[model samples]
Target: MMTFIESVQQALQYDFILKALLVGSLIAVSASVLGLFLVLKKYSMIGDGLAHVSFATVAIALWMSASPLLVSIPIVILASFFILKLSEKASMHGDAAISLVSSFSIAMAVLIASMARGFNVDLMSYLFGSILVISNFDVVISAVLSLVVIVTVIFFYHDLFAVTYDEEYAQAVGMNTKFYNYLLAVLTSITIALGIRIVGTMLISSLIVFPTVTALQVSRGFRTTILIATLISVICVILGVLFSFAYNLPTGAVIVLMNAIAFGLAFLAKLLRR
Candidate 1:
């Protein structure tokens, strides 16, 4: 155990590990904050939806030798809007809309890879995540976007809460419910895209869902839930980074497993309190 702690300490001294930890912390906080609203609103899977869209966009960007962040963010944002429109206008369920878009996007991803033949290790890194090899450009992009998400959530907290908890009430009170819904989807899209580095598209939704749901297991009040979720997410990222380094495991998967363990413990604690 001491050797493990020493190795993690050694890993933290490196620049890349520090960058990964910084980016992971930012993403975790933003994801947890936004996720509380989304989970309450029953849109928890939107991250998964946007992750699928990002997969397609990343494939195209890699095939074109373009910046993945530049390409993925815009395309995923558009897909989020599309999902929102489908849910609102087409009389479709939100989950159904997400499923349709995500399924199509994943298909497009495979098709793009098949036709363009850009199935390299770089592509795999984006799919499964490789924070250890994340570039300086990716670090900058992730940091900026994660901060944008955190700031946006802070600025629009009440409006977002209104829309999430009771959209009809918000609309009846003369709030622009439509705009808030679109804004939520947009922020979620950005969060999902940014998470590609820390957790990968395949598992990024867990970053949002696990923390929020785990918080729900223990907290009854909305504010308390958010605080607990954010705490859980931040701790998970820190521990995940350290353990992944000490054991040479995949950081993304380890972080997810850490969240699962947190959720399990939260559930047990809830039972004990009963």
Candidate 2:
């Protein structure tokens, strides 16, 4: 059996593992950044809902023999718009709107899975993630999308902060609240789609939720919170990948467990301070 250091060196020798690290780290940073605003706006579950939508889109794409990432991006973006419109125009509220769409998407995914010859390995991989199976194309797509998300967030940071902390006040001051809302939804859709490749549909939202909450236990300012969350996310992803490689464990599950441990430690630190 290889020692821990030897196992990491061996894993790094593979291109796929390197790609996983690059893409996973990018996704973690983007997710954590977006998650801060989402959690503040009481829209954190939007990630979960969009993730289910991505699952359905992936299933549909597979059924048609198309690229899942390519097909899922547009559909998930549209679904994000639909969720926002449903909440604002239909008076459904955010969580209720998310739940409505999430349940429907899960049903569609199940229906598609059943209609196929059977539950295929591809579908299983998407549901639980097969990070080691990530290809060059996956790496490229993840990099491009993650870059777009992070850059867009930075470009509109102040607007997002205004809308997140006080949408009514933002609107009262003549800010385009609706446009920022849509921007957030669209960015989140892209993040969810990209993240599914690493963490899968079932666990992707954890990447969005955990780091922000953990950071909140210690950080007081918004900027500081995002900084802490991004650092925590990157560290967790690196450790998770290395540990999973060493133990031959599931990458996505290990990552989420590591995040959970981080959260527990953060909570303990908070309690100790008080």
Candidate 3:
């Protein structure tokens, strides 16, 4: 394994790797913060499902010769809205609805991608992510989306807290619990879309779930949980990128595996402390 200094130098020396590190870190931080609330709400799978849907949108965009981001954003937003509405109307398990959407979207994407020949590498990148091929546009988009997510989360922190901790009580106290809940769903869909290029559909959910899960092992307070999750995510991103570079592995999967290893270590530490 390369030393820390070697890893840092590698990240600094290669322009493509540098952009991937920067964009991946931005997405990791965004996912960790929002993922805390998602974990608490028990809607973490929403990110996974949304990533699938975004995959479908990207495939369609490729077919139509349009900007994938432009095509994906509206679809994700609409899907989130419809899912929230359907959840309220049908009284179905939210996970079931998300799974249904995920399955359908994946099927559609497979069909579309099959029709679009000469797409093996592009499809693989979407499936597993291509950190080494990250462009300047990807970095810019990740940074903008991260900023929006962070600002929105901070702006409505109290409402989010009240709703997550006690929805009935929040409603009793005149908090727009429903609004924030749906808003979170929409924002999470957007997050997933923005993250798909960074982490890929296959491993995107890891960024959403692992950091928050590890943080919850030790943190009981909301602020502490978010902060710990962010730290865990950043560390995972850095370590994952370095490992991928050294071993010539898939960056997204390595990042996610790093997160899983981090969680395992944290769990072991907690058990030992007990």
Candidate 4:
């Protein structure tokens, strides 16, 4: 139904769409792999909480006139540290603490954004995502960060796998699981910041959790799960981008929805087989 000239015009007018697709697919791939461990560890909600922290940091960055990345780095790093410390207290459940922090962070973001004028419009894009508005700088930063996330995950794969399979044994074997946990939190924070411009605070976590979750429901092996999740995420991103382009819809939301659909279909398939 589409002609070559129409396709070319669409591509030219939406160059940012290509940029968003590239960055999002890369993000989806890495996040899907990383998310397998997070889901296995029962810390999937941490990704959602970290996104809220990023929202608050973005507000602070606007207030201070500093680069959002620089400002978000310390804030999220500290938040991650505190989360780790709280998890150790033995009195508070990790999920409860994560929920409290996520709520508080989002409230603070709203209050801060309301207090500051002229940032609300720009802020909306970050909240809901403007994939078509991704900048050259954002593309470069995302590419480099994706590389870092991928390399770190690969280098630590064995240790992470051991820890996930059995934290008790990992501790008995002298693997400082505490350190790896903190490291993962830091990595997640960085990924959240890197993802804001592409998927925004609200929807970024779908990229992190959905693909891995879906893959986990189907694949028996961890490596296979990661590979399948990455593939699924790429397809979701591509479809989401095209759907957005045709419908003039929000790209991140469309992508996330596609992911949800994939999850539903996978779940249905599993149920039918059973």
Candidate 5:
């Protein structure tokens, strides 16, 4: 068996592996941070919903011979706002709006796939993730967007926290709660669009959900929880990608399993503490 050090060195030799690590780590960090706010605000399903939307957009992009990231980004961002509109104007509940958008997107994707007869890449790859197939261009674009998500969160940290924890209070205190809420939704949309490449359409939402929930089990206080979640997210993505490469397993599945295991450990720790 290859030693751990040897395995790390071997994986780093491939440009594909290098790209996966760079892109996945950046996405993991942004997802974990945004996830903290989403989970706290009880809007976690938006990630999953947007993931499905991304799938449809990917299908559309592929059918048109366009780049998935280029097409999915703007469409998913619009879908995110549409979800918000549904809840505010139609009085549809958040989950209901999510379900409507998610189901519609999936249907559209299936229809498009059937119409086109095929895509350049395997549909399963997009659904389940195969980061090795990601092109050099994707790595650059994903890196830039990931950093945008992270920096925006840091810059608006206090305002986001205020809006997340107490929307009514935030509004009363002269904060633009509506803008922040939309901002949160837009950020989630971008993260989900990028995350589809990391963990696939099926498992991408888990990247947004698992780490923060796990961190909650083991930590308290907003800042502390965010710190722990970011660590867990980055570690899991790096290890998961490396492990899958070494073992020839499915990359997305491995990453999600790592997250599940971490969640289990945190849950166990919570039980023991109680």
Candidate 6:
């Protein structure tokens, strides 16, 4: 058997692996940052909901022979808006709105898949991830979208934090709560889309939720939590990718499992500290 170092070198020789690493790292940072706010505001399920919407959009795009990324992004963003609208006007709040949309979207995706190709390997890739099939175009799209997420979060950090912690207080203080809420939804949609390639529709939300909660176990301040979560996410992505490559395992599942391990460690550490 090849040594660990040799195995890593062999994996790095593949272009797809390089793209997966770069894109996965970017997605990790974006997801972890956005997740902090989502977790704080009890909107973590939005990522999962949007991921399912993207699933349907991807199926539709495939049925029409269109680019899945291009087709899914806008549709997913619109779905995010719809969820927000439902929450605001229909008395469906948080997880209820998410579950309603997600359940419907996933059902639509299943129907489309059945009518089109009956759940082929390509569709499996989107559902469970296919990092090794990542193309240059995928990398470029991931980079651009990830950059947008990072910059937007930084630009609106204060407003997002205020709204996340206390929406009514923020509104009372002249903050545009609605705008920021929509903004968060939009950014989250983009992040979820970017992550679909790396972690698949089924597991993308783990990237958004796990690291933040893990970091929260050990972090005391907001900025510190963000920093720690980002670091944890990046580390998990890198290590998980490497481990998956070395063992010929599924990248998304490995990354999520690593995140779970990190969470366990953090939880234990927190218990010890107390």
lDDT of 4 at 172: 100
Q: Find the candidate with the highest lDDT and give its number.
A: 2
Ranking by lDDT: 2, 5, 6, 1, 3, 4
Q: What are the runs in model 5 whose C-alpha is more than 4 Å off?
A: 1-5
Off by over 4 Å in 6: none
Clashing residue pairs in candidate 5 are none
- On the 0 to 100 scale, the lDDT of residue 229 in model 6 is 99
What count of clashes does model 4 give? 0
**Residue 177's C-alpha lDDT in candidate 3?**
85
Per-candidate TM vs. native?
A: 0.98, 0.98, 0.95, 0.93, 0.97, 0.97
For model 6, how does the per-residue alpha-carbon lDDT over 1-274 read when each residue is reduced to its tens digit? 5676788999899888888899999999999999999998888989999999999988998888888899999999999999999998998777899999999999999899889885456787999888778888888998999999999999999989999889999999899899999999999999888788888999999999999999999997999999999999999999899999998899999999999999999999999989
Over the stretch 219-267, how does candidate 4's per-residue lDDT look in tens digits? Answer: 8898999999999999998888777777778888888899999999999
Q: Is candidate 2 or candidate 5 better by lDDT?
A: 2
List, residue by residue over 40-110, the lDDT tens digit for candidate 1.
88899899989999989999999999999899988999999999889989999999999999999999988
- Candidate 1 vs candidate 4: the lDDT winner is 1
CA lDDT, every prediction?
Answer: 0.90, 0.94, 0.85, 0.83, 0.92, 0.92
Please identify model 3 stretches exceeding 4 Å from their true place: 1-8
Candidate 4 stretches with Cα past 4 Å from truth are 1-9, 12-14
State how far residue 92 of model 2 sits from its true place (Å): 1.0
Better of 1 and 6 by lDDT: 6
Clash count in backbone of candidate 2: 0
